[model samples]
Target: MSDDLTKAGCCAGTAREATDHPYEDRARGVPPADAVTQADLRTRLTEIPGGIFEMGTRKSTYPDDLDSPVRKVKLDPFLISPTTVTNAEYARFVEATGYRTVAEAEGWSVVFHLLLPDAAAHPHHPPGLPWWRRVEGAFWAAPEGPGSHWRDRADHPVTQVAWYDALAYCTWAGLRLPTEAEWERAARGGLARKKFPWGNRLEPEGRHAMNVWQGDFPRHNTADDGFVGTAPVDAYQSNGYGLYNTTGNVWEWVADRYGPRPAPGRLPERNPTGPCDGLQRIQRGGSFLCHVSYCDRYHVHSRTRNDPDSSTSNAGLRVAADL
Candidate 1:
């Protein structure tokens, strides 16, 4: 196999036998038994054994991001998508249900600051950050502003999907969005407390192992990490559990509602879901827009939340099963 493929964990030569996780065996190339059938959709459900793990970072890890408070979390065995939902897969869902994504229905979505052409066009653009433009016609089909289409991003994670949209696709596939606990546990991939899925080292050998922004913050993206925008679904190495893009590419929506962590001492020790009624849902795995200078939420335990009705070009989802 080629070195790039091996580095990307796509070689699957001797590494397949040596590093393959048994959970991945359940749905290697087969769609879930009850998954919706579509010509272009491919589904892989991986089984994740649950256990206890630290759910947040130490103050020293990321001093500024106070949202991540270290806590112990436990999960139950569940099945999750081997990869993020791709544009092609989501297209299948839209074709079948005629579902209009939030971005499409809302008539606009948030694009990164660097993606816009003229920084001065939108006066309301985040104060100092003029790169994020509220471009009209910017939806899932057209991620890079109005005229941009999904042809080149067919294998890329389908962004601009709202919580409802993700839930719809999950239901159509006879699966469900993963609970926050399930999402984090699977992301950890059996590796206890570590900065990323692979380990504490962001780039073990000074090489970009995952798809993330490189170079200066919002002004410049060198694409040294192999892609300036979204990369292919399999563009990066899988975690210990054989799951791909768990930390980067796009933010994934989970099933649980958003709420403050239970006062550290009062948190649950077993399968804990978020609050009963909340306005926003949990989103995991930062997106391609993540940069060290701006947002470095690509870590395994890192998380963010958004209103259920909100959708952006950098948000997407993965499905999970109870069995």
Candidate 2:
């Protein structure tokens, strides 16, 4: 947490080092995979009748993320959680398996500077991303360093969970992370080429559709969406397919790997899983921190990447299963 901390390697040493902050030499450990029988998941997972859909966007918001070269993607029917994994759901996994998240194993994680209870007390800033702070003792259980806990936000989507942590939870819950194409198909909510799940308009009829930053970035939040950090999993209206918080609340980790933009003339890919040798994984949907002024990746086609062991205050996961 000190300013003198230099950039170090991540939990997955074979992968590239994290550019954000220094880390301890913790070996990447996989959580124990439990039996694949989740009765509770049967009721929570919504069936998505999959088919071919135009993936990506022609009107690319962030061209470098490769949100362009729209392609036709086909997927078989699958079941997905209506919302991101909630704190209560994750608690069950922790209590049953006694598993520890990567953030907890590393003894620290990234937290938004403003979300810190005493931002002024934390003088050091993360590299490149000055809006974030490398907070000691920040993990899924205690989100805002040591003082804050997830007890009050049990219904909210669990954050500060690394991609590996999410995979562990999915393995324990008898589920899997959705493919990037599958995620986009479900997030579209049956709409075609729309910026949002609802439509092109961010706010339809002057009503907030999802939880996103409503004010100037890294400065002030109007909380016009009724939430500054995270909202309840089902806080907003469900999408056309009865899915909630598909576009906002948290950046959801998908099953695909991160790669460069596709060639413009390449043919359609059937159930693409990104490049076979790619390292970092892809995160879709945007988080509550997303704003037009700064990180406006809340739209359906938008995406970003992070190492498998990366965890933050605004990232979480949604589970998917075979139908």
Runs off by more than 4 Å, candidate 2: 1-37, 264-267
Q: lDDT tens string, model 2, 118-206? A: 87766665455566777878899899888898998999999988777888887777778999998999999999989999999999999
Cα lDDT tens digits for candidate 1, 1-323: 11110110000000111222222232222243333362123336888986667777765344433346677877777888888889998787667666666556556665665666654664333334445555667777887566678887899988777676777676566777888888888887788878788898888788777888788876788888888777888777888898888887888889887665665666546888778875666788877777777677888877777655556667789888886
Return model 2's CA RMSD, one decimal: 4.4
Q: In model 1, which range of ten residues has the least summed lDDT?
A: 5-14
**C-alpha lDDT of candidate 1 relative to the true structure:** 0.68
Which candidate has the top score in lDDT? Answer: 2
TM-score of 2: 0.89
Query: What are the Cα lDDT values of the candidates?
Result: 0.68, 0.79
TM-score of each: 0.81, 0.89
